[model samples]
Target: MSAAQRLHQYLRDARRRRSVDLALTLLPWLAPVALLIARWQGATPAWIALLVGLCLIGAIAWRHGSRLDTPWLIRRLNALRTDMDDSADLLFAREEGLRGLQRLQQAWLRQRIETAPTTELRPAWSRRRALVSLLLAALALAAVALWPAAPTSAALDRLSPSPQIAAAPGQPRLVQQALRIDSPAYTALPPRNEPSLEGRVAEGARLRWTLRFQPQPDAVALVFHDGQRLALSRAGEDWSAQRVMTKSLLYRIEATAAPQAQTRRLYRIDVTPDRAPQLRVLEPDRGLSLMTPGQKAWPLAFEASDDYGLAGNARLRITLAQGSGENITFREQFVSVRGSGGARLKRYQHRLDLAALGFAVGDDLIVQLAVDDNRAPKPQSALSPSLILRWPADLGSEATGIEGMVKTTLPAYFRSQRQIIIDAEALIAQRRKLDGEHFLKRSDEIGVDQRLLRLRYGQFLGEEAEGEPKLPTSDSEQTPDDAHPAEAGASAKTEAHDDHDDHGHAPDAKPAVFGEEGSVLEQYGHTHDHAEAATLLDPQTRKLLKSALDEMWQSELHLRQGHPQQALPYAYKALAFIKQVQQASRIYLARVGPELPPIDETRRLSGEREGLARRGDELRAATASDPTLTALWRELEPGAGGTASASIDYAALERWLREHDERVPDPLAFAAALAALRDQPECASCRAQLRGLLWPLLNRPAASVRPRDGGDASDRRYFDALQQARP
Candidate 1:
């Protein structure tokens, strides 16, 4: 290639490298600028900023390209390489049109250019510039991302217009206004002065308002939306009022001038309530822990927090349950624990020595923390979930008799009938030592044990367990049939059937033969009507068991009525019957069903649903709308054709607002919007404001859309191919 062609190629390479360096230096700035714009404006503005940045970058690249043209390259080549004898332009001149001297010069320069290195013609990369640009961009991005949001009240102060002081001629016009707030001591917040009347303050904060009028009025008062009116004390030209902020509300200034009038705008005061303390247990990992061998101490950690300051000390309530069965003893004690940290949050640590608390095997120690906040008069308190440390009892082995028969032993914790009798006898022996009330209480407790033991035996006899026992008037009034109603019903039905023969003969009719009694039933019908033969137990034994249940019931009735002495006789008798029933020989077991195949261990707990389909939940959308709110929105909407002065049902709307004030996001703002619309119904901005507030409160109708079905692999492949074939 000729020198001009080679130089052209060199210039092309230089321009490409310069363009890349320029992009590296400039394009990185797009991210930080876009983020800054997004924070100031919104997403759409950020996109516009990016586009503008790109256009500026392109313009700078064009200017830089113009400065590095062929002429500029020729100058740089001549200045750096004097050996070419300043004849570099001759290389680019058209050879045929050039003069003899120029043509000869071009040929000589081309020969020299090929021998000399062309590396000097290339542009240097802006490495430092690019690095600095990237560093600045990253710093800017971090600063923007970490910037905190402005306070809500500060933003509202900027958005909401200040109350207008100008009024009609002869009316009392507000000249100046100032509001000061002093937060409660518990909050430890400094007092602040609000520039506007509408603002928020902490609960129990003292709020003082001072207002001056251009012309002195007869009287001035603050009228709240809840129908409460506070008369401001007049002192010279200024009127002042002070109150403790307890709840959020809207209020307007009312001045009794020549003609009584109130301020058209409603100011808002929002109160932030103090939250209750929150207690969380951090140690032990789990609520229930078992004591291991040689383990002596249980370490516990707790963290408590409150919006304001917390009380000085927290209470740790420990309950120890010792002993077993009906005689279990529970001892509760409270320990005051001091915590460390700031007033808002504190951490508590305590280690419990198991042996120090008299905790033995088969005993449980339940511990809970109760924390309180610094709210005055009545501090709000919270209790943590109970945690238990248990020393588990030893589970005894089951006894086995001869012939591979297993004898089931009752758990020691379970109260037996004999235990109930023993408890009653002991209470009767201490009756003279105890007061009437204490004696009665002990008797009542024993009665509960007796009732529980009776229910346990009733389960073996196939009796339906009832919540409360039915007490008979007297032992003489109770009968066996009353205790076993099912048996009584079966017996009554059998007697009725026997009175009516299968042949429909009269009661006095003679039999066909002497041995023909129940002959028809024997040949045609099967008989299962005999209640005595229904069970494996003999009739006499069954009768004895039924009598024991009746005796136990009688004992429970007297014991529950606080008469342990009267119940002792029946309790002893029931225990004797139970012993007799236990000593009887012959116990029968029911026949078992056929055994099935064993379960697959691999599939157990695998969470596999091979053939099962998921059931979709039926979600019923909330579509109910308040009629009052809907009507108000319709009237306030643009082009509704309602005049600005159109009459509204203020009473009805007020009633609705009062009923649902809690559900409203900002009750003060809602009330102010409503009042503004009522004051100037024709004002377009007022209508718009009220409409905006009401839009979110109105419920939308639920859409009825058919769900799309999930297709198979073949269907998906077909769709993918179709998309690929699209233009």
Candidate 2:
């Protein structure tokens, strides 16, 4: 390449270097500026600014380089590149006389440019300046990143249009006002004061306003948005008003003087409603619990929390499902929960005995803690999720199919009792080594296990009692209690049918013949009625088992109260009772019946359908006998608007009902009225008819029948009478 081409390249290279150095110098400044812009206008604007800054820096550097043409390059070369003594300019001259000189000078210039060190020729960067700028920028970035988030209120206020406050000229102006907020004692919060009129307070807090006008007004009153004005009593030169804040409200202070009326800024009272007490089951940690073999009582540990305080309105609800399959019966009850601590926080614990809850061996117990707060008007309650405790069916027997090789005669839970004893002994041995709290916790845990085992055995007895069938016999004939686990095992093994079952009888046994196995009373008996044959424990045995469970409960309570030493004696006694009861022979008596006759070779097993129609007529005739229920039932039907067989004086009934709307004498009558009203509320005439019908119920006394026996004989009679009396 020629000298000019080389020099041009050199100058171009120098320009690029200068641009880079200038960019480096401006880069540090650019970053912070971009970041600052980003803070206000977002990343897009910051990026735009950075791009503009880099372009400007590049343009300036390019302009400087563009100025350095061949002549300027010669000058810069002499000044910074080589020691040409300013003669390097001659190398680019194109004058006619200087052509030869130019050629000779070109050679010298080419040599000088070629040999010139690139470092000196290239643009120099302000290293210290750039370094210092970078350091400052890094510090700035760190500060920005580490800066705390600004208050939202301050930011919003800055952006919002300020409202101009108009002050009355030469009037008694309001100067200072303070709102003293005193929360309710239940909240247990100290009184607080806010300089501004607007403030938030807990519900039921008392807010006292102290206002001082420039010149004390003759009268001052607090005006609420609801138009209720409360006059402030005078205290020295200031005016004050105290009002309990039951709900959120907006109010302003109005001061009246001789010439003008002054009003303070409008303020809003923010009232926070007290939340309902919250219940959290801490121990079980889950909504479902499975009692391993031998567990008797549930050790419930829970927390009750409220913003204010618990109103001591907390209870443990227990629901027990009795029986099995489709015949299951449900019973519910509420028991008091212990440990009602203060409003902020309270830990409660209660050990519930399955026996006490009326839970049977295979029954499921659903328990939940319900808590209410001390809110006025209407208190709020919160119920924890239900915790289910189920005593699963014995694993030994099968309801159907072939039996397994190993027949577990004793229920699985029986072994659980032995495990409990082992656990209790282990806990006792470790009690001395453990700290008081740990020791007590361990002891209580073992006590809970003991209670559970005791209840397990107790349920065996309870089930027998519930399952025992009542037989007609003399008082001298002892009524055996079916409350034996061994008997339960037998029933389980036999897969015994329900009391209502026909026991392989023909399907024609619609009205099942109830009788003991083969007594002469079989024709008039319903002994096969499983209801009659239900199992029960002997009364004496039942009482003993109940006492044993009670002792176990005492042991648990004592252990939970942190007295392991005191609980041991009761625990031992309960165990001893359990053993005694286990040792007792609970012989279940099987009823004997005559052997069946040989079946006829030519007969089929088909049932006789002959007498069904007559039997149904008899059943209907029996049902028609109850006149009151039949009349009530007829009146409740929508189609029976005026089909009453008996005369009812509508005018007199309407007048009576109007005079005595609350005095419905019959429970069924009240139900009928409600049903009629619900059936056709919009029909005025129908409503009047229902009201007329209600008068009879209001005038008539409640009807009740004492069942001759515990069976459905009384119900059958009542239904038959009702059917016969139907219009």
Candidate 3:
């Protein structure tokens, strides 16, 4: 062969060697991955494992083989052969394309390569790495082979079968059983069969049970835990029954021959419910958005998710609220927007054109997204929270005073006291239509609005904003007549002041000055002893305002307690008092200092300290403990120690649980525990379960350090003698 042919053969051999080395280096790592996939699938077929393995090998070969081309082999050959002068590429090139100098160099290189060894051209292989990887792969395979397999339907059936009862030798025995589940169409799941009688299925799925018994009984039926029975019709040699799964329950098979008998073992069926679609708005971060000038379109994005799948299209409810106040007009329109994403989660986006929606200044464009899940019969739907795009109205500036003071009015969106009263009345009217929980929630929301308004008004009286008003004191709890005695006294004083104004002068009254009236100290001195003297209103108006604040406090209290009906009376009274204060005239007068009363020297240090006693420390009683729960706890305590009761009054304990069920963390679980304990009185675990459930319900004692016990008589006498000796 020529020098070029020998070089070509050598390059071909090197490429094969490189491919083999790569395959060997990668096989161990890829084998573990394929094995892990097969194990995760749980008893995957051999054909599937083979196909996955072939695909992985093919991918590795195609990716690594592409790098082992002729140019790469030539580069390796040049790097290994020092005498070639880096002209290995010329040997592969066509002789006709080679120039004079290249031709001369190729001839020289070919002569040198003809005698060069081909073994030196092969790529280096790491024998130690390959050996270690092979060892690890072998160990991994052994571990996987020995690992316990996941439990299948057949295994479950073997573990939980009908109880073995010793009956007559001719009694029928269950030969074969099969449960076929047909899931709902919306779930897009194919029908499947399970050999186990106890299995979890999707809600609303149809379950068909088929059982063949040797020497068939006259009749067969399924008895459920809820006291319901389903009879199975005889078909050929098998008994079959079908029902739609709705809830989780336990059931047992019953067969009747000459003597009827029910299986002692109960089969459990767990149902997974279909959840409603949840819609979340993603574009507008806040519920309320202000429209800026020159804005043309409002873009909205929403995401809806469901356990099964979301519908193809979602409804965008758009409501245009125009104008302001009671005269406002609302125009509602719904737009269908197609969603794009996986079946479980879908995203819908819509860009609303401002011009098409007829959005204008002083108008609000409210939009909410409504989505439905792919549930059959009637799909459960959800509505996103309403997002308002407000185009605020322009309020012109008012330059009224010489200093150009700009006056601003309250926002029109601010809810007023009258609106609160109206909402309370409307809620009362709709109480019969709403459920108890929803009604209470609505009442509480209105109460929150009322509290915010009360806090705003309190700002005028220099009161700090608080979450809840202080509980009414004994003085505040009195009737209006008794609570507002200052009103009566102020009215009487006003009448006397009016009488003075009517007459030119009184016999005992001094003449009034223009700036300094009533007393000479009032014009120059400042006194804060009386709250009414520093206000801009007269005593009578201040009293009315104070009464209004107290009424508001009462209204807020009842409203927050979900008693809108009881709060209406206080609300109306507060409104009436507020109206009176609004209509009262502002009487601006000079600051007045009170006249000093003459000191009584006889009463000042006479040492006649009668009717006075030192203040004593008052003690509050701790919360009372429930005796029924205590007795139940004592009876349920584990182990044979500590005065544990022999028997418990379960009826009394049940009554107490019913009364305080709201306070229990999980009342249903607690009831289940009680029932379990009652049915299995001798069970130790049952007793422990009941005790655990009862422990949380019992009243927690105050976390105070236990007081040290009083010493014996002799120790007390010694301490007393020591005290006497010290003196």
In terms of TM-score, the best-performing candidate is 3
Error of 2 at 30 (Å): 69
Runs in model 3 deviating more than 4 A are: 25-45, 48-63, 93-100, 117-119, 126-160, 165-201, 210-215, 223-229, 233-238, 247-254, 258-272, 279-286, 292-360, 374-378, 396-727
Please provide, for model 3 over 526-547, each residue's C-alpha lDDT reduced to its tens digit, 9 standing for 90 to 100.
2322354336566788788778
Q: Candidate 1 clashing pairs? A: 644-681, 644-682
lDDT of 1 by residue, 491-544 (tens): 222222322133221222234454665766544443433443346466677778
Task: Give all candidates' CA lDDT scores.
Answer: 0.76, 0.63, 0.73
Estimate candidate 1's RMSD in Å: 32.4
Give me candidate 1's TM-score against the actual structure.
Answer: 0.44
Candidate 1 minimal-lDDT segment of 10 residues: 498-507
Error of 1 at 155 (Å): 25
Model 3 gets an lDDT of: 0.73
lDDT by residue for model 2 over 1-727, one digit each (tens)?
5556766777788777766666676677676677777766678999999899988878876776566556666667778744576787766766565767567776776676566554355556668877887898888877776675333322322221123344556556676666677788767776666667678899888877777766667888887654579999987866788898876666667777523223434567778888777778887777777768878788888898887767665688889987765789989989887566665678878888876777667788888888777676577888888889887766553243454433557433344544555666677778768888888767666655554465466544532212233233343133245434443433333222233333222222235345545543444444433443334566666666777778777876876676666776777777777777666535556789999999756545665555356634432123444344445555545554433423344334434434554555433344334334443455556556655655454334455554466348888899899899998
